[model samples]
Every structure is written in structure tokens, then in C-alpha cells.
Target: MALPCAREVFTSIFKTGAVTKKFCGQLKQLGKVCNDAFVKKTLEDPIYKNLSESAIAKKSRKTWNTCASVIDISPSSSA
Candidate 1:
């Protein structure tokens, strides 16, 4: 993924924001393996030490599935 797209995704996951459709395309291109790996690595962060790993994993799966569905039904855009 491009740096900006990656940053957007990181913010959406760890902070307060949503990933734009443009970045969704990038994430789709990267595929689930990369996405899961990203989440797995994030689970190692100290900030998430107190959080439940299973909960985070479940949420991450939901995010990925939502993005997948959105990209599937929506027309592709240049933005």
C-alpha cells in the first residue's frame, strides 16, 4: 500500500477515523494475508497490552469484511 493509504488505514484502526474508499482499494489489493499480518503485529504493541486479543481480532475481521463488501458492491473510483 502507498504510505498515505497505509497511514489512513492505521489511523482508522488505532485512532478515530474511517478508511476512505480509495484506501479500501489499496487494502483489497494487498489482500487478507497482509491485513491479518498487520493486525497481528499491532497486537504486539504496548498500548494494546491490556485489551483482549480475541476482541481486537474479531473487530479487525469485521473491518476487513466490511471493506471487502463495500468494494464489491460499489463502483470503482479514481479517488
Candidate 2:
């Protein structure tokens, strides 16, 4: 995924926003390894250092699974 798409996905997971379908497709293309690494890096950010690592990880997994299901259910589309 591109930087913007990664940022968008991070924001969507950490904050209150919906990720665009186009970005979801990009994420699906990138697969879970990239997603896991991205989330792991985010866990190291000082801003989130005070938060529970396990909770953030659990949420990340949930978000990834949700996005995967969404992308699987729909045909790919442009942003």
C-alpha cells in the first residue's frame, strides 16, 4: 500500500473514520504481513506508548478482519 493508504488505514483503525473502498482494495492486495508490520510499528509510536499494547493489537486484528471481509464482498473500485 502507498503511504497515504497506510495513513488512512491507521487513522481509520485508531480514530473514528471510515476507510474508502479503494484503500481497502489496496490493503487486500498488500495482504496481512504488511498490515501486521504496519500495526506493529504504530504500536511503537510515543503517542500510543501509554495505551495497552494488547488492546491495540486486538483492535488492529479486528479492523483487518473487518476490512478483509468488506473487500471480499465487493468488486474492486477506484478511489
Candidate 3:
């Protein structure tokens, strides 16, 4: 879901030719782009996110770990 369109969002956010991290962060604060299903799952699911991680590869476990940390440390912004 959201992962599929992450590149698109990234490109859209960087269209101004400004690739700075701060610039990209600022653009993310702008309008809507895609459906919220996956985003909601990442934000609302259990901390372990077993069901969600079932779809991901074992080699990518670190990805989930980082996502969980973001959710734990910054629940308000994780969404």
C-alpha cells in the first residue's frame, strides 16, 4: 500500500530540485497523496506487529524494528 507509493511521494516532495533533508521534511507537511489503509496499519497495529511483519521478508526485520521504535517514541508523528 503505502510502501508502493513511497517513491512517488518522495519524488513529489523533491520536485523542486531541493534534495535537502530539511526541505523534504517541510514538503511532507503539505497535502494528501494516497489511501491511508497501510499508514493506519503501521500506526495502529500492536507493537510487535506480527501480522503485519508476516508479509515482510525476514531479512527486513530491522525495517519493522525501526518502524516500531518510531511508533513508540513518537506516536503522535508516526501517523
Candidate 4:
């Protein structure tokens, strides 16, 4: 389940402003593809799906909390 080298990935999609939201959207699309592929590949693996409900909730909460932390609250913020 290893990925390609970072240099190879960057060479295929690199551009100026590649770290911006537009580029992020591209990455998110790729992420969805990768996630679906992973789930497809691992659906039969009970270990991957054995997490407790609370563990799943904690992970979901952590994701949103981290996203909230990244929000720019100041009017003068460059973000």
C-alpha cells in the first residue's frame, strides 16, 4: 500500500500557487479517491473496522477541532 515518491507526485502536479486552496481541492479529490480505494481493498479486514464507536467519535471530533483551529479569526490575518 505504499505510495509513489514525493518528487514523482510533485512533478506530475506542481505549479505556482500549488499550496493554495485550489491546489488543496485537487489534493482533496485525490484523497477521496485514495480513501475509497483503501476501503475497497480493506473491507474484508476486520481489524480495520474494529474500532469502538467512541474511538470513531473521538477521531471525528479531532478532525473538526483541528479544522476549527486552522480558521483565521483576525480581520488582519493574511490567511
Question: Model 2, residue 53: what's the lDDT?
Answer: 68
Model 1 alpha-carbon miss at residue 19, Å: 1.3
Error of 4 at 40 (Å): 16
Better by lDDT, candidate 4 or 2? 2
How displaced is residue 30 in candidate 3, in Å?
Answer: 23
Give all candidates' CA lDDT scores: 0.74, 0.73, 0.33, 0.35
Q: Distance (Å) between predicted and true CA of 22, model 3?
A: 15
In model 4, which regions exceed 4 Å deviation? 1-48, 72-79
Q: Give the least accurate 10-residue stretch of model 3, judged by summed lDDT.
A: 10-19
TM agreement with the true structure for every prediction: 0.74, 0.74, 0.23, 0.30
Best by lDDT: 1
The residue-by-residue lDDT of candidate 3 on 1-79, one tens digit each, is 2343454433333222222343333223332222233344443556535444333222123333333343332212222
Model 2 weakest lDDT span, ten residues long: 70-79
Model 3 residue 45 CA deviation (Å) reads: 28
Candidate 4 lDDT over residue span 1-79, tens digit each: 2233323323222211123333333334445345334334443467556545454334333322332344421111210
Superposed Cα deviation of residue 21, candidate 1 (Å): 0.8
Model 2: per-residue lDDT, tens digit, 10-71? Answer: 88767656678888889888877777788778878898888776766666676666687788
Candidate 1 lDDT over residue span 1-78, tens digit each: 999988887766665567788888898998877877897798799987887777666666666666778798332221
Better of 2 and 3 by TM-score: 2
